[model samples]
Target: MTLAEDEALAAAPDTPDDALIRLLSHRSWQVRWNAAQNRGASDAVRLAALATGDKDLAAAVGQLGDALSSTVLEAVFEHPKRDGREQLGCIAHDRTTQERLASDPDLKVRASLAGNNEDVPEDLVRKLAADRRAEVRACVACRHALPEDLVITLASDRSALVRWWLIFTRNTREVAELLRDDPDEVVRDQARGVLGEPPD
Candidate 1:
């Protein structure tokens, strides 16, 4: 571990809040993460400043769940820094956070939100089914909580990979319809595997 990392580890909750805030500017990403994790609200505000100032720092701050608040999370989600958006989308846990991530212009950010099993709205999961990135679509297909209609729609996605994911994992009767007209042979095979019958 680097000196920054060591300093960060030292600035746990037991440490004075001021000391932890100062450590937010540490050169090491690990140290920043530690500071963000251990700091109080005031310190977290200070750390957010550092996080928003630099993409690397923002990424580190994103890893610090202990210091996170709905306010700070909103700021991170809206930060001009792209890297921060990726990390923020991964860790944010509230309705506001999910909304921001679902609407993010970056597909990776949206995908990260979809991958998070908690707090994702059903509407957002449906939107993710049409994401340009296959990874995002795959995440949507894997989300078992998605409404049955959304799952059925995703089961016919153009990407065979996404279609196969729904076909094999989803047991909804609605999914059986996709098998009847699946364009991808592999997806058709997977759909057949689920129903124990060949496609027409």
Candidate 2:
């Protein structure tokens, strides 16, 4: 690792807030990201300053993630800046932030929102299930917290991998009937295994 990388890793969570705040302006993006993550609430003011001034989008987003309250996130989410909204959405847990991400013009950002699973709303999960990207849809399929109806929809997806993943999840019964004639043999095998039937 480079000297900068070593310094970033050496900075601990308990390090003085101002020291961490100073590191946020380090030339290395990795150091700035690490410093932002370590700042927590103590460095919120410094983070808010960076969120508005940092030229690097990732660094700005990282600063927003470390903000003391949803206040900084809310500010960045509505900032006319436009460049960092997607990255901000990737970390912001507030419902309004999530709603904006769900409808973002960028599919990758929408996919990032879907991938979070924990704070993303069920309606958004359902919407992402129909996304053209298999990776995004797979995220929704493998989300254990998703409602049974959403799981059932994903279980019937054309992607065999998605169906197979759903077979191993808790709500297998919801899609048991749908998988009886799955086009992929491996998926059918998994469904049968989950249903306790002898494998073919």
Candidate 3:
């Protein structure tokens, strides 16, 4: 942070205006950050810096006016970096992006999309309810607006945990009686609690 270091950052690099872009590949995050903040930086410069997995520079890129558009979000989901792909399902407002991420091949990312209720597509959620992965089905059980039929489907999910997650949902009354005989003792116990006391 000394004047000498500031001057070093300001000095022209051999690569024309590409100095800021090239600095994004530097070994030190400090150098990459200083370049990200350079007044003359371009979107190309910022995006290159963002793709580096530097949290601060990524935050800076996210603050840009056009950040998080569907295409950019898609690229983030497609990127080789884990941090970028992990951010895919967290985007709430863009239905196009949400739909794209919902079909992602990665099970973890699909589970994240399964749980998002805001502006999320119902068809996509329903499709996710049938995902081969029990973890994704468990997340579908956690969604607030699920259809009653889907709730029943989850009630019988092969994974005990997936079936157990359905206990927190309220509209499973039609299936609650069947769950009384569930092979899993904990699921049977949860079904009793969800159904309350039987007629005396």
Candidate 4:
């Protein structure tokens, strides 16, 4: 395979899974690395990454994030390759998986759990809402269909960024009213923008 073709294979976001599987074993590490990073990479790719023992490639499996099934994620957490833990939190549906990741030291991991999964349990959502980090709380704010009490609570969040995301959820009338006079100008402006829009 030519370097140019390898580079093209590496860079193309839409590279098919079969091609990616082939590239995972290709002679060129660069092509392999790109295949690992592609969004289309699948559980098979992750399994291959695990087998290859290339830490960076294994870590790139994080890009698959919410796309991964619990079975594969179990493999990821079991593996020592630690870099991708951040994105793996997205698909953590199992209570044990959520519990393991919920208290992880890394905020990116917690934030991914907070924002990425539609099926994330309400209890976990509550825990993430109260996270000390604004980044994690902001991710919670971006979630749709939060419990009503949470809408009110996040509307008054100490972090302006959290409140800003709350405004964008467009979940309740109270959100606009609570933030219309917010101390943060950007939040106030966003609140104004959504004032007349119907709540979702």
Task: Write candidate 4's Cα lDDT for 1-200 as tens digits.
Answer: 78779868866867777788778877777878788776666677668776677766766676565566777777777766555676567654567777777787878778888888767789888999999999999999998659989988998899998998888777356688888888998888778766863322
Note the Cα lDDT for every prediction shown. 0.68, 0.63, 0.66, 0.77
Question: Counting only residues 3 or more apart in sequence or on different chains, how many pairs clash (N, Cα, C under 3 Å) in candidate 1?
Answer: 0
lDDT pick, better of 2 and 3: 3
lDDT of 1 by residue, 43-115 (tens): 4544455554777766665655435665665666666776666776666666766777788888878877787
From the highest lDDT down, the ranking of the candidates is 4, 1, 3, 2
Best of the two (1, 3) by lDDT: 1
Lowest lDDT block of 10, candidate 4: 191-200
Model 3 misplaced regions, further than 4 Å: 1-42, 54-67, 169-175, 196-200
Which segments of candidate 2 are over 4 A away from where they belong? 1-30, 38-60, 63-91, 171-174
The TM-score between candidate 3 and the true structure equals 0.66
**Tens digit of per-residue lDDT, candidate 2, span 44-154:** 634444564664533355335434366655555555554456565456666766777777776666766676536777777787888887767776666658776777678
Ranking by TM-score: 1, 4, 3, 2
lDDT of each residue in 117-179, candidate 3, tens digit only: 445678888888888899888988888887778877887889988877777565256666867
| Candidate number with the higher TM-score (1 or 2) | 1
Candidate 2 colliding pairs: none
